[model samples]
Target: MSMDPVETFRIEAAELLEQVEQGLLDLTHRLTDKDLVDAVFRGLHTLKGSGAMFGFDDLAAFTHHCETAFDRVRKGEVPATVELVSAVLSARDHMRSLVEDEVTQTHRDAGAGLLADLRRAVESAQGKSSAPAPVDPAPVAATQDAPAPAAQAGWKLWFSLPANAMTNGSNPLALLAELGELGEMHVEADTSSVPPLDGLKPADLYVAWTVTLRTDQPRSAIDDVFIFVMDDMQLRIESLSAETEPRAPAEEIVAEAPSIAASADAPAAPSSIAPRAAAEPVAGSGDAKHGKSSESVRVPAERLDELMDRVGELVIAQSRLSQLASASTDLQLRSVSEEIERLSGELRDTMMVLRMVPVATLFGRFRRLVHDLARETGKAIELVTEGESTEVDKTVIERLADPLVHLVRNSIDHGLELPADREAAGKPRTGQIRLSARQAGGEVIINITDDGRGIDRERVRAKAVASGLLEADQQVGDHELLQFIFHPGFSTAQKVTNLSGRGVGMDVVKRTIESLRGTIDLTSTPGKGSEISLRIPLTVAIIDGLLVRVGDGRYVIPLAAVEECLELSLEDDLRSRGRSFISLRDKLVPFLRLRELFRTGTKPDPHQKIVVISTGSERVGLVVDQIIGDHQTVIKSMSKLHAAVNTFSGATILGDGTVALILDVGHLVAAGQQQEAQLRAAG
Candidate 1:
């Protein structure tokens, strides 16, 4: 991968934007939650700096405005109002759109709308509520719920450059240009710490600034200006109110409220809260007022994939060396082979870590989803997420978002009963959805569950039969009937609504899960809610694989799916000739011959091998001609021509430069179950 610094910044900026959006959404739940406020402020602040670093002048300028508003709230000059939160939330989306517009060479509204909204939100929180309210009634509650912030003294700003700030090429002048937006400013450069010009180090920053700003805007506006330089202490601030009244459209009413400008007993309140306004820049911060932080390092996704590709090659080279050493009597070759194998194994372990990402990133999106869904459905839904720190391959986590969204939406639309209906049924009015994830046995399990109206088996059966998906005389179990929901054109809604029931989304979820080589389980209990679960391999692009030969062609089975491998004995082979079944631990497990399935013409060997593979609850044995041992498979997606080739997930290159298809264990197990069904019918 090219080490393009610009691309690196782009990815980081996007992540920060998401964090800001989440913080904005969370504000509604915990209006006084200092952490969310700081989090949102920190995200916006970092975004502004990073945007400027990448020459995104407009982005940097716009985000600076938001950072300021959050800053005031943090310093206690203002409180978190629903109106303020909603305004910032909308502005956050606009900022993302702006970033994309810049990248795509499209029209840039120059962040004008977002900037205006941000200013309005800040102003309203400062006791001026008339800032550009939407014509629609959606935001009406938010406006009424927000209490204007208490007035403070004029804005006070302090900045301490990171000791080596100048060496890093950060310009203090830029911080100054934006701070000018907050009315009159008196900047006092702290040169007392500076050494004489002769004794001075050119790259060392010996100067800091303390600026006094006189402005009608809230103190947050000033804090926003210094968002980028915050950590370096290049900026610290305390705001106070001037004796004269600042005129606002809501000034006449805001004047009616007694203002809390300054308290002689608490001078540090404004300043301490000022720094704390930005979100958790600190790592592992339990104290809400003071956040945890560490220096951040950014890496490119392409670089990670490039590293994985190299590791794959190293694995193949080591495999060839291992084979050569096994066949040759040369001592030197054998020694080199052992050394290479050890090094490659260690490198692969390191590469896995590099490719891993915390699941918290994925979980963050649900906060907003739940919030919007609650607003739309007029249902009180509290989403509880667990195991947020679970880690998975970045690619796996990315593809799982859409399916999870649909599942949660389905739970809200049908699984969750209306509030009044729930209450009438002797249940709590508020519905709860639990999203949990954990790594188990080389795969990750994600569960979406709701405590609402459970799936109605009768309704499902009726829909299946009406849609010609089930026989009128069929007696499918409740769990089996639930699976029918994922069928194309299968829906059980009595009346179609905006959320669901057009017979769409579920099939797409099925298609996507299968594409990722993941399995979905539908479990339901009448009046006890339903749980839709997905079991996904940790990484789709790379897997630890067991390479084997069935005929002349080889296949790779995911190492995670291999339960056990056994050699076929004459007694066991003859006992199950017509039907393929292996007695493992006194339990009969069905087996499939891959050679016969592929229609490969080959004579049966004297002895064969059976590899036990499974997905979720089903178990199947794959009979092959030979055991080829373990290989690190670099998964390559099949071309569009092979997209419908459900039997195989993808193809990987072998050590001999030949391609071997990676078998999809879930698909094969299902096929085996179908075969068992056919045999039962014939019997």
Candidate 2:
């Protein structure tokens, strides 16, 4: 099915908004960066143009104001300041709402208020610059998207598009019309490349243009006309000397044959080289805006997801085939099945690579969040990020966003102190928040660390006691005590604030993480800030699992979590009966008996096997009846009736079509740790 242009525009606009936001955030750090200023202006300009073309009038109109503000900054008429960045950041959000078809009166009012702040900031900068340079011609404030007066000099521009330009959806005529809007213009086409009637390719662009423009607009304005085709198109622009005539024909200087200038009144020539006017334009020439390659295609996320589901089914079918091939006596059938197994495995790997997206896309939104939080709390917060290139499953990235937002907010609101307080405490006035991601084994570990006053244990304990969440005389470890923060409606704040203090954030964060089959760890020091680490699987849809047996049932342990498999001697089992601990590499690792945990009500295998799995620094051994080799497991969520079960995360189809439960490694490891604690207490 073909994609709708409007939907495509909305998607592209969403991306453009990210660019604008990122540029604005970067500008905050380096206010005087001309390149950053120009980058932001160009993003806004393209958004305005594309939005207007896509019939998003409100979005275009709103974005135009921001574009105009940045345009002045581009021309040194105004300065890029925090206030301007903050105002534009707000404007960016409104643009997002419009793109998503969520525009309302509230958005309109907020847009107006933001625009007013933008105007004041621009006017304030202009008032300052007006005196420093008395002859500045730009207005202190302009409204209704007034065009800036073109630069006072004339310019000559020549551009030749690629042969497939028209086929790519770019209309050269629309570009000419935009040029016309700049100022007095004389446009001529060089149709020298046009083939004869018998040789013509109707969609091929065989013409070039030499435009003599007398406008007060900057060179960037003319550059914007060809921005869509700038990558491969040959373009040249030069300032016209005072003595040179702007309208001179191109053949006057060239040694080759004189160029033919097609007149606007010229009778319509061959359809192949027909020109389009800017007013009545065609769709874009398939120009991948913002430096993206035209060779790439935009597939709906749903389509990719559907493809993944099919691949998952194929993996299961392959598993069943592998089981059949092993049992078959026919050599030919076995050979064919083996070949299919290899191909299916390769296809599954390829499919997984397609689903992996860099974590950078997930981290991009936090810059804006940090900026707003800084303003709302009246604190100076700096966000530093690392390991952005680490890739995780697309689904994982999507689900993680909300949880990360809550953690960041909690850090800024309750963790970070005011600038004066930070200064008095012998720390830098600006509190720093570092968000980093990395791949650890089969999981992605994301850490949100801050340089702020850490969690106040005394306050937390008092709040817990007052709320009856804990007994005053009851002793608790720091790790267990911290769990109180995730209790719904729990807060230690002295007073309620707009951003926080009513509680209800950390608990949601915890729930979301647990839903993804992930775990969160929190650590803090009284004076030295806090850190929250989230550990989640790299991909949730499919996994390589080590199939094992316990009693009469089977289970699949995530192979990535599996370190090694070895037989547990009967003597060792009896020796460590109560402790359930194994000594490996001089370290004591806890072990869990799967048969006993599942209550299988069957005798244990004489020679049981131990599967060692580790998550970060923690390791646990699972003693099973037998190691049934490896299998490709397509994870299927457990039914709602079993949703509350903690030992098993999901179930998968086995080689023989039986339902094999997928073990929840994180939960098993935690259970092992708790068992050790109980054993120590008994001792």
Candidate 3:
């Protein structure tokens, strides 16, 4: 099927914009880095040229203006001053809206304002570069265009695009046409590699090209033509000068006639010289070959999700087969079932890896966020990211974006103190916000930490009392007090602000995380800054869980959270009847009797097992009837009737066609903690 050129351009343009943004952000720290400056300019140049080619005239025009501003920086006529960087950043965003057909009056006005600022910055820098004594431009031009130098400057380019390049949306003809625009050029095709008519692939490009060009444009220009096709394509470019070795008769004849003007309209030019032996293709901006792309194929995200769904079904079917096989006396059937089970397990693991993406894609956007936030708050804030390569489920990453934004914004606005305040407190004038992620067991833990004034406990307590969330003399631990921040319409800010502290964001963040079957915890030291950590499961679709029976009901506890299981002797159970706590290695670990918690009046088994599970540092034991071995739990959402149950996060279908509830470790752990607090208060 023929791909749409406009859609192809949009995808390519989006990637170029990302490069442009990254380059501009990098330049903010190292303004004098010529490579960074050139990188940014080249990205803008390609986007403009490609945009115009694909019929996005407005985008092409807008990007050209920004490209011109960066061109000045590239030529050393203007420094990449802070003002210029900021202006161009804004322009870059406007260019995106234009490309996406999302431009509005506001965008137009913002673009105008940014362009105005950019012009002023460029003019200011130009005044400095041009301040030196003016030299005669006529002599400089004559020196630049001297015949000897011009003759030595031209390049011969040979390009053989990938066979499927056209199918992948590359236009070789358009590329050759662009080369014609570069300078005086002759182009010819080499058809030696083309197969016979019976064997030809309609979508494949079988011919190669050789071009002799005379231009002052750098080799980078030639490199840009094959930017989108650089992967696995053969391209060679060599300097052409008087001293260069003369070509053979056939090669000379092939390279001589059909100047770019002569073959401009020819669809089938004659064969040219063979490609210069093994000259590696020079890639354009951000086209560095990391070897991964050569073996990769692009698949739509929905297709991946669909594949996961099918895999989940296969796992369920395999489970049913295993259950039936174990009951039958057929030896061959049992062996086949075990083999199928093994294969299904392997497939599940492979699917998990496919769904996992590096957290770096999530972290990259925060550079711009921090840049803008620093300016908005009038305080120097540096964002440091760690463990960006840690992989997590793509769904988890997408859902985490908004909550992380709220937390990071809160850290800057309410957690981090101003420069003067921080300095007065004997801290660095520039506050630091660090975002770090790592996979622990089956969960990905993400922490947003800021080194500034931490949460004010006394003030929070006072506000809690005033707001009637607590009694005036209510006593609570620091950790319990922190939970009040997640309460709906809760805030202790002295005054409301536009960005936050209007009693809005934090509760929503908590709700969103909980909906994803995750937990968030906040820790703060009065003067040592604050950190909020979110622990989320790696994937929600299927999980390895330990199935256990509590009374007559079955429950699935995430195996990732299980520490160990210990048999609770009747003597110890009877001795600790009222006070449900056990001493494990001299540590008093709390336990909850599931039969009592669930009010399942049925008598428990003589020998009760305590399943010790943990979330982070808190450990709690659940007393259950029996341990039913591990099962692959495909989670299904609870209906509206059971949505309010805090003890279970979701339900899963067992192999026996019975429904089992998945335990919510966060809720259970919190309950255990509260029970311990109550016992202490009574004592």
Candidate 4:
């Protein structure tokens, strides 16, 4: 389905806004960087022009002020300052609201206030720098062998819009009017491309234009006039000197009329002329690359999701066909099933790749968050990101964003100390928060670490004890004690503040991670730092699972978590019956008996299997009646009635149509670890 043009503009505007914010944030570090200044200006310019083309007059008008401010910075009329960047950053947020929602009184008032601040920032910057604004240089002489000079005093431009321009709601006359705003101009339309009445397409654009302008603005300003249409339109710009006549054939030189000369103060009124000779190519002109096609297409996320669902359904049907083929006597049926299985597998992999997106998209937003946090807390802080190129399921990225935000905010608010305190502790005045991610097996490990005062064990214990979560003088490991921070309404803060100390965020983070079938591990050192690692699966839609039979019921274990399978002989099983521990390579590993856990009265098979699974450093063994080979499992969410069941993450249908439960590896590992601790305490 074709997307609404207005919706498409919204997406493009969002990306432009992000670019503007990133550039402004970068300027906060290097205020004198000219390249950054130019980038900021270009982003703002393109956004304003595109907004106008899309009929967002309010946005276009509001953004024009910001574009002009940056233009001054680009021209050395004003210097880049933290104050200026902050004002623009705040305004960039308002631009997002303008794009997303309709304008209201509140929005108008907010925009006015932001523009007022922007004006003050520009004025303040002007006062700080007493240097005179740089003067525009004289137009450079053009050479036959050299590129067109950008510092031209006058320009002659010829351009034609794309055939679909009219259909896509573009206005060539409005573009001409904007060019007239640059300076004194003369425009002549060439109707040579227009076909006969029967051959003409009303919705298509066929008219080409020739425009000559005398202005102090550089060639870049002309390019900005067509920024939105540059990728698909034919455009040629040639520099001209004031004294030189236009390089045109005698037949092309029609009578020059005074009324056709568009003044900077007036709207453009272009005239139509007779057919002229084909435009001559200028040296170093990018005319050859006009109407270039893009290599990639933008696809909506919902469409991708719908396609994934179809692929998943196909996989299930293929599995059923394979099952029937295995029991069939006909060789052709079996062969067809095998081919379908292979093709379905390939399609599933391809669909999975389409749904994967880089973690960089998730990490980029935090730079702005950290910048704001530093100002809010009055503390010097730096954020370092690593492994941003790691790719994960798009759904996982979306769900993980809020949890990461809560974690980062808590790190800044609770983990880091003020500059004076840090200096007194013989540490750097500026605290650092490092966020990194890497893939391990089928899981992505995202770690958020902060270099500052670590979690205070004493305070955590006090809070836990006071909240009745622990007894007085109860002994607990550092890892276990730190987890108390994630308990509901638990806090070590002396008083509540805006960022943290309310104790509402961490528990939600824990719940959200658990809902995604992921686990969180917290580690800290005294007076050093703290690190929180969240291990989440690469995708939740489907997985390769080991189909195993426990008693009369069958279950699926995630293949990523399976280490190795060992035979549980009747001798070893009876000897270790009560202990529920298995000996592996001379080391003891805790094991869970599914029959007993599910309270199934059916006896185990004579030959049983112990499937070894591990999550991070913890490992556990599951004793099952039979190992039923591997299956491609499509994960289906559990109903609210089974939400309390921690042993199984979800359920899936088998080839024969029976439902099988998918094991929750993280939950089982924690259970095994708890059992190990209990056994040790009892001994």
Candidate 5:
């Protein structure tokens, strides 16, 4: 999709933020880096201009104050200092909040404090610099015929208003007047479009004008003059090859075009641009120069979701066609089906790209988190991030934020050691926390590792046993004991401060990850700190499924979880209802009977099949009447109406218009665990 002006601003704003943050950090190290100072000033200048144009007035106003202060520094009048950089850093965050306002996200407490600090800096700097020169007004010239466009000295613009210009409330006079604000300019009115009195529509535009403006602004500045009427009025603004105007304060110039908009920052012209009967043309200030135009259109996020839903439907329809083709003997129909399948696959890939976003958006948050934690805990800590460009589904990114925050906080509060204690142990005073992301197989792996004193296995084991999460007499490996920390209400910290230790956050992290159908692995060494890695699927929207016919109903087992399919004789199937076990590769694996579990009453086919699936370490085979081959399944959430039903994650439709339920592997795994627990208790 082509980016509109708003999107353009967003892209530019994002880069500006990166520059501002990096500049702030570098300034923290070298306060006198002139390049960094200029870089920051440029970023602020662009942000202020773009924000104001896009209707972010509050942001523009706040940033304008900041930009003015930075501009002073760029001019070498203000010295770079820690307090100055720190103030700007804080202002950068406030600017972010303002930009989010463009997207209408919630962030409050606008930059009042930042503004005060900026003004203080500006006033202080001014005290150390030469007095600023005053701005000169436009000098009415009598060289209208003596000048030769100043020999490429400035811009000469020629623009015409539509026929009904004056009657339509566009005071062409004011537009010309605003033109003069840039510099000395001469205007000639054309009334050719204005018909005779008998043929005129009083309200219709019927006038045009040609003006030579001498200003430093690019052609874009001239376009701003008629921006409000650009699309409707056949307005064409071009550079004048040459201009010879009498530089005189002529009353005739205003008399000829006594009906248009007022000049920006200049005296009101005889002709009002607003065409409001020679009255005030400006309701607000003319400082905006020209009206802002956006390159991108603002589309609500919900509309994109709707588009994705339609695309999902199209994919499912294509899946059905593919199914029908593989079964049919007609060559032509089969060929068409194959083509449709290929096209649909390509389309789906494109849609996937639209939904994918880099994990860097998530990683950017930790800078602030780590910075705050360092200040709070008074520990020397550094945060390092890697693989920021690794892409993940948007939903996954949203869900990953909370858990990541908790992990980083825990590392700062409990995992890292105090600087003095570290020096005593001959370790560097600064603790390092590394957050990295990488794509491994079908999952994205995010690891948050700290180089502080690692998790004390002994303390964890003691906490697990004492908290009743583990039995005292139970003989458990350190790995198993460490896992218990993910159990709710289980923490090993000796005491509870604001940081973590009170045994609460980790369990939520575990639960949230599991809810996303993800896994977390924890590893740590006594003196090497801890690393918690999260492995989550790239997307949860669609998957290949092994469809099976159970009795008369159809079911789909996720192909990711299914190992292989098996055929069974009637005798073997009938005899295994009470206890189903399959011999695969010389190993016996337990299985579930779909007929009995789904409570299907009809008789199974004489020849049946078993679909073997596994979740984590447990493997289970499902007995069905027949295998329905592989099908592309679009996951449709079991509506809030059916959300409580645990056996199935969602439902899908087949080629012949049959509905099949997609099994929830996580649920099945839990069910298997429950059965095992019961059996062991009985024994």
Candidate 6:
């Protein structure tokens, strides 16, 4: 299906807004960075032009104001101030609403307010930079040996856009009008490239243009007119008055062209002018200019999800075929099954790589968030990110965004000390929050670390006791006590604030991470800092799982979490009946019997097996009746009836068409750890 052009514009506009916002945020650190200034200008300029082309009039008009503001900064008319950047940032958000939603009265009101603030910021910046504004230099003609002046110059230009430009929502007339605004100009259409009527495609643009323009604006301003279409078009600009010879007759130049449609203000032509070499493709506007056109295609995310679903179904069918071939004695059938299995496996791996996106895409948004949060909280915060290049499943990144936002907000609002308090505590005034990600086996570990006042264990304990989450004066480990912060309606703050402290976010964060079959670990020092580590599976769709049998039911353990398997003898099982612990390398690892846990009401197999699974540093053993070898598990979500059941994360179909529950490794490990803690406490 063809995508809606308006939707395409919205996507592109969203990306441009992100660039503009990032540029504005970076300007806070170095107000006079010329490169960043140019970048912000280009982003706003492109967004305005594209928005106009796609018929987003409001977006175009609003973004134009921002573009003009940055354009002044680029030309040194005004300095880049924090207030100016902040105003543009707010304007950038309103521009998003214009692109995304129907223009409502509320939106118009908000845009007006933002623009008013933007004007005030510009005035404030101008007041700070008292230098007299530079006067426009006279357009000067030069000989071949001397360089052209930086001021405006007379120019002759010829250009044609890509053939499909009009079909892709570009308006040649609008472009011409914009060029007309530059200064006095005469435009003539060159129809020599037009094909015969019998072979012509109406959607294709075959006409080119030749123009003679006299403008005080710099050459870059002229270039900006075609910024959106420069990549695939041909353009040549020449200094019309560079020659030392006398001027040519106007009639002679007009007669040289087969078809001439001149503007009303056409002036006498100069002597024969040689065109400057074709302009190199303008660069540094955005990622599109970085030669990605030939290397990548923009695909809808839902299409990828559909493709994944198809691949998963194929995997299940392949598994069934493999099982059938293994049972049969036909060697040819078995060979074909093995070949198909290999091919499907390779295809699955390729599909997964296609779906993996860098965490940088996820990390990039936080820069803006931190900027806004720092301003809101009146705190000095420096956000440091590492492992941005680390790749994770796209779906994981999408769902992980909200949870990470909550965690980072909590870190700033609850964990970090105020600037005054931090200094009083003999620490640096600026607190740091670091976001880092790395792949550990088949899991991605994301850590949010903050160098600020850590969580107050005593406060958490007091809250827990008052909320009845703990008995008063009860003994509890620090880790256990800190976990009370995640309980529903739990808060240590004395009063509610706009950012947090209403007792709402942390519980949602915990539930969200758990819903992804992920585990969160928290550690902190009283005065130093705190870090929260989230261990999440690399992918949620399909996994290499160890299928095992417990009583009459089968379960699949994620192969990534399965460290090793060991046989549990009848003698050892009988001896460890009450404690449910096994000795491995001189350490006791807690074990859970699936039969007992599920209440299968069946006797155990004489020689059962223990599949040792782990999440982060915690390990647990699942005692099963049989180890049924490896299987490719295409995870299917459990029904709503089973939504509250945390033991199994999902279910999968076996070769025999039986449904096998996929164990939630994170939940089981936490359970085992809790059991171990309880036993230790009882002793």
Best by TM-score: 6
What TM-score number comes out for model 3?
Answer: 0.85
lDDT of 1 by residue, 543-604 (tens): 88999998889999999989999998666677887888778899878888898898889865
| Global local distance difference test of model 6 | 0.82
Q: What residue pairs clash in candidate 2, if any at all?
A: 150-216, 150-217, 151-216, 151-217, 168-285, 169-284, 169-285, 170-285
lDDT, candidate 5, 1-683, per-residue tens: 65566666776687888777877776766876878876787677667756766677887778877777775565555666656776777788888877765433333344776778866765664565465522211111212322333443455443455444443335666667757877778777655445689987665554455566666554434544554445334232333332233233332222122123333223223222323221223212111212322334446556666767887798878877877888989999999998888898888788777778899999987886776677778898888999999998887898889999999999888789999988987789999999999996556889999988888877887887787776778766666677788888887777888887787889899878866666677889888789888877777776678888888888888777777778888899767644556678997677667787789998878887877776545677777888978888777777898868878978888777778998876667556545544454555
Candidate 5 — worst ten consecutive residues by lDDT sum? 133-142
How well does candidate 2 match the true structure in TM-score terms? 0.85
RMSD (Cα, Å) of model 3: 6.0
Badly placed stretches (over 4 Å) of model 2 are 102-107, 134-160, 163-171, 186-221, 224-229, 232-294, 466-469, 563-590, 617-619
* Model 5's TM-score against the true structure: 0.66
TM-score of each: 0.76, 0.85, 0.85, 0.89, 0.66, 0.90
The lDDT per prediction is: 0.73, 0.79, 0.79, 0.83, 0.69, 0.82
- Return the clash pairs for model 6, or none: none
Per lDDT, the best of the predicted structures is 4
Clashes of 6: 0
Off-target runs (Cα >4 Å) in candidate 6 are 134-153, 243-294
Estimate, for each residue in 1-683, the C-alpha lDDT of model 4 and write its tens digit: 88899999899899999999999999999999988987888888878877988888889999999999998887677889999999999999999999999989899999999999999999999998877866432122223311344444676676766566666556899899999999999988878767799999787667778889987666657766776666556565555552243343321211122211221122111222222322222111122232332346788899998998899889888999999999999999999999999999999999999899999999999999999999999989999999999999999999999999999998999899999999999999999999999999788999999998998999999999999999897788877788799899998989899888887888999888977888898999878999999999899898989999988899999998899999997888899866888779999999988888888899878888999998766789988999999999999889999989999999998888889999998888888878877886777
Cα-based RMSD of the predictions, in order?
9.4, 6.5, 6.0, 6.0, 10.6, 5.6
Q: What TM-score quantifies how close candidate 4 is to the native fold?
A: 0.89
- Cα lDDT, model 3, residue 155: 68
Model 3: lDDT equals 0.79
> Candidates ranked by TM-score, best first?
6, 4, 3, 2, 1, 5
